[model samples]
Target: MSNRWCAVVRCFVVGPIGNKFAPLGDPGRQSYEDSLQVFEEVIQAACQQVGIDPVRADQIAVAGEITEQVFRHLFEDDVVIADVSGGNPNVMYELGLRHATGKLTIQIGEFGQLPFDVNTVRTIQFSRSPRGLIDARNQLERALQAGLLDGQDVLTATRIFQESGEGKAEIDLPLPEPSIEVDGSDDEPGFLDNMIEIENQLALMTDNADGVASSIEVIGAVTESVGAELERAAQSGASNSARLALISKYASEISEPVEMLEKSSADFASNMTSINDGVLSVLGVIQNGDPSELPEGWDGFLDQLIGMAESSREGMEGLNTFGTAAEGLGSLSRQLRGPGRKINNSVGNMRKAIAKIDAWERAARSIKHKAANNPVG
Candidate 1:
């Protein structure tokens, strides 16, 4: 081995001695310890064959917690050497992680001790004799040099060396051009996209609801002020023309604001209902675990929802302006319709929409309560 830095090899010496040695009886412990000593000797001999000291090798590392630490090391290390003699769960898990990370890994075991799954992978098998140990060490070193040192990558090596191999490589075929059909109606947004847009608009309404409600308060105040002025004018025997003119001017001034407020309030309420519905739909999907169980594309759906939520914040600000405008319109409309027609038709529409939204909101709350009591996951 020329002192060239090829790759970092993390050697994890896992077996019954390091993990489940104490579980065995007294006689078993002696046998286990003896086998571990032989394994250690073999590892040292293998390291020596490659002109590396087992104690001073920088690339080599060990792991104890196979579930967490071993997998973590597999990602961090370039190569892994797993001792799979004892059929340890931790060792198997670590090996799986190494294989998953697509890293170069070598398996070693005492003769006749390797598990069937591990035996499928080419591994060095050693006997207890001095000559057998030497032979095993030399074989392992040669295998490592070929697979790990000479850049014969693990994925390629695994595919080639494993008996039950992946099929021969197929030539890449060019994808055919998609057939396009011209349809003028297709340019319009789809139902889902429209729903998404509505959801975005609704989010805006919720964020500015307080501001909108405050504007409503202002409209009420303006209406009360105008009402008081009209009452005083009537008592003072003012001309119908002047009284009507004042009322009309006030109504005109506040009509746009009230209309804007009503529209925003309706939109706000609608958006709130839509948001609840969207959340419920997602929760329902999650609860059933049907959509989540999709083969590979489930993450894309989650990402789409997240993207919609993130982009809706800007739209909410526009809804706030709409609320202020609606408030002004409501103030103006109150003057036109006297005490006989107290409520404006636009306000009535808004109130109905708000009521529908409230029903949805309550239903959504109930759904949340039920979901909390009964979690699917």
Candidate 2:
């Protein structure tokens, strides 16, 4: 949203550069040189409009570990534009890599040349004609603007997997070492130490959850105020540039809070998963063994589980509040396309966090229930 963020936004473009058949009725084939022209005219121009410096894979001038460099950029860059026109194997492979990261990615292709699997994804279609390229460039610019504003808007392969419900989704994080040592000593720490670790993690997660809620509250208030400003400006017949300035100011004001929500929600989810795994591990032991087999801190373990469950529930409630507020922000600015889409994307992320914490709470409660029902012999 700010020129500062724009100055550093890195983008990579991956697509086929070799000659290939054009759409069915338009042209029989397109040359490699023509493809380059399309990139220069359409994709790169759109990227520049959005303040992104796009570097195509072929244009990479670096010498060291070129493959690694390519992969790294695909994985870590702020934005990726994949042209799937020819379904080129190399381009597809690189696009898949970008998809897996769940970052901001934009797809573009010729109308009929899109691969069957990729056709489902929303892609900007362009032809080689002057008018066609203009339309594509405009669409690409909007897509880039929206995506750069809110990365969560793009449903990459990673998001599909996470939302699929086939399995519990896990975001990659560097998890800490297990609290209990595996050296099988009778003196090795048991439930107390692990429970303490769980408590600490839960505290961090709760803090982060609260942080997210507070940030979202700020965002909601600011969004409403900005929306009102925009509406007033429109009612008074403000110039387009003036309206744009208001929008840009709004973006600048909310950027920090939005970033906070993003980071805190992610941290909250990671901490929840870490503690959830610990709880599940303990739950498994409780379910499989006689209650009498529970170690010295049996009662304390159940009590702690109950407390964790309560804390998790509270966290979820806060997150749900923020989620609703975020959704409202999206709706409030629906007329303003860019901000609305950005807020909506953030709602998706909030939903993911809520779902994870919900599962974590369930596991904690189940552990408590099993302990209560499975009495010692």
Candidate 3:
């Protein structure tokens, strides 16, 4: 993958780029430039956080047309940060290109400046002040670091499209012949070698499982925080529109952490399935073939199996904790949506959030059940 860092935006000016956004700069060019600088600073901070040298369109040499370079970066770069403030037509168009490819893209904009097309999608918002810049940097930095380590491209726009019930991009992968050889030749992997490999895989799965469990705890905490905020709004601002708006913003804020946890948990489950199959295959070989090749105590094979079983047990415990948290969500929902509640107006959005929590709980339970029913060794 190319290490190119890309930022998609237009020239900072008073008027909209392509009749897309309302005219700005009743305050003039400085206002435009100030907002763009906030975008630039956050991008640089995020790049540094993820260990990528920051590069912009003008900073890099290009042998082709400017549009060509822009498209290439959007498609080829590991990450492309887009600024959607003022709904710049060029930036929005390029973001659509990135979305079509379902590539990794980070979006930020000035608060409340985005149009409806991009508004429903998640976008980090920042102000043009020093404190706001620092907050924006920290928030984007955490998100970028997580994406860098996830080992998968985060297709945010694709998710938004699917969630909106729009048509999905069809994905098709052609299958190939099996690459693993089990002919028992010297060229093929021997018993001890395969055992060692499976052992390593088991360890990685266990670590990933731990990460998932920790993330679930974070989910529970964030959910409770949301509950508290809603209660506050109900008590003091049930009739206040501004308070209701603040409540909506806080609900959106938790989506980032929730999304991060969901991604990590899904990856954890996939790894567990692969590791389970691999360990069982190795166990079959050991039981059927010569056991003499293995050293004393089956050369740590049984230990690895036991470790995997213990890890699966821990994963189940985490799921149970998540279920308990889900119960809390149901209780909280009753209070928020039940009869005579002041926050009844906010119940619709809160239910959407609760549904997300419920889905996560079920996923955790399913993974735990699969692990429990399967043989560890």
Q: lDDT of all the models against the reference? A: 0.51, 0.66, 0.52
With candidate 3 superimposed using the best TM-score fit, by how many Å does residue 135's alpha carbon deviate from the native? 0.2
> For each candidate, C-alpha RMSD in Å?
27.1, 15.6, 20.3
| TM-score quality measure for candidate 2 | 0.41
Q: By the TM-score metric, which is better: model 1 or model 2?
A: 2
lDDT of 2: 0.66
Tell me, by lDDT, which candidate is best. Answer: 2
| Tens-place lDDT digits, model 1, residues 1-377 | 65243222434444444423466667667656655665567765665555443321222222122343433345445556677776767678767655654556777887887888777677888886888878877887787667655654456434553434332211121222212111215776433454456456555755545545555566567767877988999899999887877778666655665555656655654665555544444334333343324234333434444443323322333333333454454344455544212224334434444443433333333334344445547
Backbone clash pairs in model 2 (N, Cα, C under 3 Å; residues 3+ apart or in different chains), count: 0
Local lDDT at 162 for model 3: 60
Q: What does candidate 2's lDDT look like per residue over 1-377, in tens digits?
A: 33444536778888876644456344434546656876898888887776666887666532344676687578657888888887888889988777777778889988778998788788898876889999999999888877767765645567676577422222222323344432346876565566677767767866886787677688779878988999999999999889878877877788778777777767776776666667655545554455565566645655655554445444444444455555554433434444444544545555555554434444444455555555556
Question: Please, what are the lDDT tens digits per residue for candidate 3 over residues 91-117?
Answer: 778778777655556777877687667
TM-score (all chains, Cα) for each model: 0.35, 0.41, 0.35
